[model samples]
Target: MRRITLWLMSTVAAVVLLFSYRTSTMGATAPDTPGVVGAAPGVVPGGPAPGPSAGSSAPPGSTVVNGTVSQTRWGPVQVRVTISGGRITDVVALQVPSGNRRDREINSNAVPALRDAVLRAQSADFDSVSGATVTSDGYRRSLQAALDAAHFGS
Candidate 1:
C-alpha cells in the first residue's frame, strides 16, 4: 500500500511539473521591431530609406515593401507586403523565431484580420487584429513600412 501511494504521488508531481513548463514556455511572446532592407537594415530607428531612382523600371504607382513583425518576448518577425494602384499585391511572413508557440498562435489569430486590413487598406490605415493585438499591431506597422517603401520608393 505504501509503495503504491508513493508511486502515485510521484507521477502526479511529474505531470504537474511538465504541464507548468509547457504552459510557461508557450505563453512567451515575440518582440516587434523594424528589420534590415535590401542589403541594409530596414527598420532604421531615425527614419526611412532613400527613394528609388527616377528612371527605375518599376511602375509609377507600384510599390515594393519590406519590414519586420516581432513579439514582446521573442525576436523580431520579418515581413514583406507589396501594394500597387492602392491594392495589396502580396503579403509575406519573412523571419520568425523558433520555440515561441505564442508567436505562432498570435500569427494564426491575426492572419484573417491582417488579410482584411490589407484588402481594405486605404492610405495604410486599417484595424488591429482581434485576439492578438500586439502581434497585429506589429504586423501592421511592418506592412505600413513596406507600403511606404513601395509608394515613396524608399
Candidate 2:
C-alpha cells in the first residue's frame, strides 16, 4: 500500500508540473510594429538579407515594394521584393518571428527556402516549408502583398 501510494503521488506531482509549464506560444500577442521596407537597420546573421532602400531609385524598369506585416501566432512576418524587367529578381524577408529560440530556428530554415521558391515561381503560390507551416503562410501572405504593391505579374 505504501509503495503504491508513493508512486501515485509522484505521478500526480509530475502531471501537475507538466500542466503548469509555459511555452513560448502561450498567451502571446502579436507586435504592433509596422514592417520596414528599406535597408533595415540591422541584419540577422542567419536571416534574410536587406533589400534596397525605398527612397533609392530602382533601375529604369525595376521596382521595389514592401509587403504588409503579417501577424502570426508566433509573431509578425513581412517581406520585400525587387522586380526587375517584369520578373522577381530578389526577395528579402523584412520581418520574421524571432520571439524565442524555436522561432528563430524554424525561420532560419524556412525563410531561405521560401525566398528561393518565390524567386523560382515568381509568385506566392509555392509549396510551404514542411515543418514551418505557420511561418510559410505568413510569408506567402506578405509576399503576395508585396507583389500586389509592386503590381507584379499583373
Best by lDDT: 2
Give candidate 2 misplaced runs (Cα > 4 Å): 1-22, 27-57
Alpha carbon deviation, residue 35, candidate 2 (Å): 8.8
In model 1, state the lDDT of residue 13.
100
Predicted candidate 2 versus true structure: per-residue lDDT over 76-107, tens digit per residue: 78787778777888888877887777888888
Q: If scored against the real structure, what TM-score would every candidate get?
A: 0.51, 0.68
Error of 2 at 133 (Å): 0.5
- Please provide, for model 1 over 1-154, each residue's C-alpha lDDT reduced to its tens digit, 9 standing for 90 to 100: 9999999999999998987675544543433323332322242222222222213333445555556444444445556555566667556555443346666666765675676676666444677767666556666666666666555334
- Residue 35 local lDDT, model 1: 38
Error of 2 at 108 (Å): 0.8
Instruction: Indicate the worst ten consecutive residues by lDDT in candidate 2.
Output: 39-48
List where candidate 1 sits over 4 angstroms from the true fold.
1-62, 68-74, 96-98, 152-154
How far residue 49's Cα lies from its native spot in candidate 1, in Å, is 18
- lDDT measured at residue 71 in model 2 versus the true structure, 0 to 100: 80
